[model samples]
Target: MRSTYILSFLRISVSVLFYILLVFSVLFLVASIASIAGNDKAGDLTKKSYSYRVKAFGLQNTNEPFTYSQDSMVKYQKVADEYSVVLEPSSTIGYYALIMKLVYMALGLVILWNFKKIFKETSFRQPFKNTIIKRLRTLAALFILSDVIKLLDYFLFNSYLHHSIASTKFQLLTDVGNGVITGLVILVIAVIYERGKELEEENALTV
Candidate 1:
């Protein structure tokens, strides 16, 4: 009963998240089309804001001692260790970045759908099923592909920043290998499930 509740909860949560992402993806798709159709205003309006970790060089500390309250005085510098930049459709690289984002969203949607289907078809009583193994494999592939696309986006962003900015060096600080790791873990679990299903079948035959 508790597991039933948990599974239901998970299904609901994933559904909520999936719909939210789907809405955003649809918006992005429209924006992508607009960008492709020479709609600069629409492109600018729908441009996504991306954050990157920054490494600053030859920067001065502009923090001056100031007393905000008489009880406590504090000084702070107006410098950002990370920055968010919006990519527009002004150049070829920007278009590539946008297309990559669309691909990423598409993969993400498929991944979520797979998860939803798995959770729907799975039960605590029958956890290891053949259908789930296939879905898991599909999800794993999507995860790995999403990770690759992410890295490509990072490279594209890095290249864009390298040519655009001079003072501060921007780096993709987000963990890149998690998707592949997760995909591999799922593959292992699928193998385990396959073995479990075989043993279950063998037990059924012996009885």
Candidate 2:
């Protein structure tokens, strides 16, 4: 009974987050497209801003004793260990960034939906089902792919910056394989659930 209430709460939470993210994803996609298409305007309301975290130095004034690198494009404040770069939505690098963001958001939405599905189909009494196994496997794949996409996005954005911003050096900093671990754990659970399902069916047949 306690787990039932917990499941009910989680299902409701997932549902609410999913719909809210879904709406924002749609609006962002539309606005990004419009901003990319009409990039000739100097200042536009549709122009969205994206931010990236990187391992880079900050811009500061240099003295006679201590000199630091400065560039016209690199505008950053002194921070510890990392820097946050805010990029405007333009026709070049911004478009690709926006697309990657949308894709990542879509992956998150799918993962949440799969969780919602599993919670809907499962209970404390009977938690192992074929549908649950399939959904778990699906979640596993999505989690793995989400990490891959993040790496790809990082590389692509870094490459674009390397070529475009010649004066500044921006290194790519990322979590290399965090999601892979999570995905592997989920896959193991799915396998265990499959074995449990087989035993459950066997016991039913015997009874």
Candidate 3:
């Protein structure tokens, strides 16, 4: 039926979105681990140049106003040797990394659970209304689960970075943003599914 086709299309679209989220989550987890490992190092060259100034002038003298040619400042900044910190990984970052890994893993499992129906043969069709409503519910549950895991990660990391509670708070805000967007998408899907079901029932009754 026309309604059945519409439901099928919705199912396919939602499944694609789910897979996209799964891929993104996996990439984020990988990047987080790499960052924690110090694979991507970043430093302020200006800080290093300042250190050289301290060496040239005694620490107290260096604090005094000094002028440098623009060229000199540029050259020094460029020539500053890079140094690596012996960063013992923050328990906070490590905890976050672990949570990200777990979340992605769980998403993968869920995707696998749904893959057969979404990707395989086409004979198994529920009523258009029921099919869409069920899929939307599933998507909502997935996002909610992801959000919960993210909140746990934020809390664990924030607790460790308690000295800068501000930074932790900011991280929580960002996570909330992501969660909100996903939550909204889920909500929209749910509403549409329900409306479609209601319409289908009405149509049936009228017939």
Q: Rank the candidates by lDDT, best first.
A: 2, 1, 3
**Which candidate, 1 or 3, would have the higher TM-score against the true structure?**
1
Q: TM-scores of the models, in the given order?
A: 0.73, 0.81, 0.43
Please give the CA lDDT of all the candidate structures. 0.75, 0.80, 0.52
lDDT of 3 by residue, 1-207 (tens): 886686577668767766777777678667655555653333312211111010111122223245568776532233122222221233444454455566667775574445434433333343445554566567667767777776776566445444433322222322445655775687686788688668878988999
Candidate 2 lDDT at 7 equals 88
**What residue runs in model 1 are displaced by over 4 Å at the alpha carbon?**
32-83, 163-170
For 1-207, candidate 2 gives per-residue lDDT tens digits of 787789899999989989999999999888877766767764342436677787654445343343345755544455455667666687466767787888889898999999989888987788789999999999999889989988887889888877766666677677869789999999999999999999999999999
**Best-performing candidate as measured by lDDT:** 2
Candidate 3, which segments miss by more than 4 Å at Cα? 1-96, 108-127, 160-174
Rank candidates by TM-score, best first.
2, 1, 3
Error of 1 at 170 (Å): 4.2
lDDT of 3 at 79: 19
- For the record, the alpha-carbon RMSD of candidate 3 to the native fold, in angstroms, is 11.9
